[model samples]
Target: MRAHGDFSRTADRTPGMTVLTVDLVHHPAHSVLTLHGELDFASSDRVPPLIDAVVKAGRRRLVVDTVGLTFCDSRGLRALIHAERALAALGGGMELVNVHGRLLRLLDITGLTGVLAITTGPGAGQAVRK
Candidate 1:
């Protein structure tokens, strides 16, 4: 996963402060990319490269796991929309998992709840192991 506009490095150059941790993960299944992160301005820029890489990798379906995300801003929401559009252009699709709290509310308020497929809780759509 590529991290763009990471303030962690800039913070290091300054001083005094300790450190802020931003974690991101990309789980590519058959044709999906599951993401877990804060999804704020600090990490929003990272979404594009991930999408690009996935497209280049020839994946069609994208599933984003938002279960671990604690927060998200408008920019972050836009990133998801942009990803969906990009995938659509390639005749692919995207889905979101573990939507809850502020993230769910944001989607509702922005009228995206109906536009995106959102699964909730731990067992919303778990895959069975063989």
Candidate 2:
């Protein structure tokens, strides 16, 4: 557990570079990881450690809030899948919320709409297949 919030630090970046910022928010029932910026190859690797930290802190259920997520490539998708599997292996679960636009379409096109537990729209909670 690295404090109660902002689990990952803001990495130093050069001009015109995009970076991912992951914030940890603990809810009564689960932990929420808020992702911001592009989730491409360079930033995808940042997710796993945070997931591990959350699990290490005794959290099982995790909700990945993509409200601020601007982009997600295949590697980003892989990171998400890995997180879901890692949680499931520990008798836990993970879900995505606020997914829309290209990311949603990618999931749908890749058949991940059925593979990953995701919820869309305002105030989403319950998981639904696309």
Tens digit of per-residue lDDT, candidate 1, span 1-130: 4332332344433354322233333345424444444566656777777788777766766777666577788988999999898988888878787788889999999999888878876675352110
Q: Which residue pairs overlap in candidate 1's backbone?
A: none
Find the 10 residues in a row with the least total lDDT in model 1.
Answer: 17-26
In angstroms, how far off is 89's CA in candidate 1?
Answer: 0.8
Question: What is the RMSD, in Å, between candidate 2 and the native fold over all Cα?
Answer: 4.4
TM-score of each: 0.73, 0.82
Give me the candidate number with maximum lDDT. Answer: 2
Candidate 2: give the clashing pairs.
none
C-alpha lDDT of all candidate models, in order: 0.66, 0.79
lDDT of each residue in 1-130, candidate 2, tens digit only: 2233332234644566556777786665688887877787777787888888878878898888887788889999999999999999999989999898888999999999898988887667442211
What TM-score does model 1 achieve against the real structure?
Answer: 0.73
Model 1 spans with C-alpha error above 4 angstroms = 1-29, 121-123, 127-130
Candidate 1 clash figure, as a count: 0
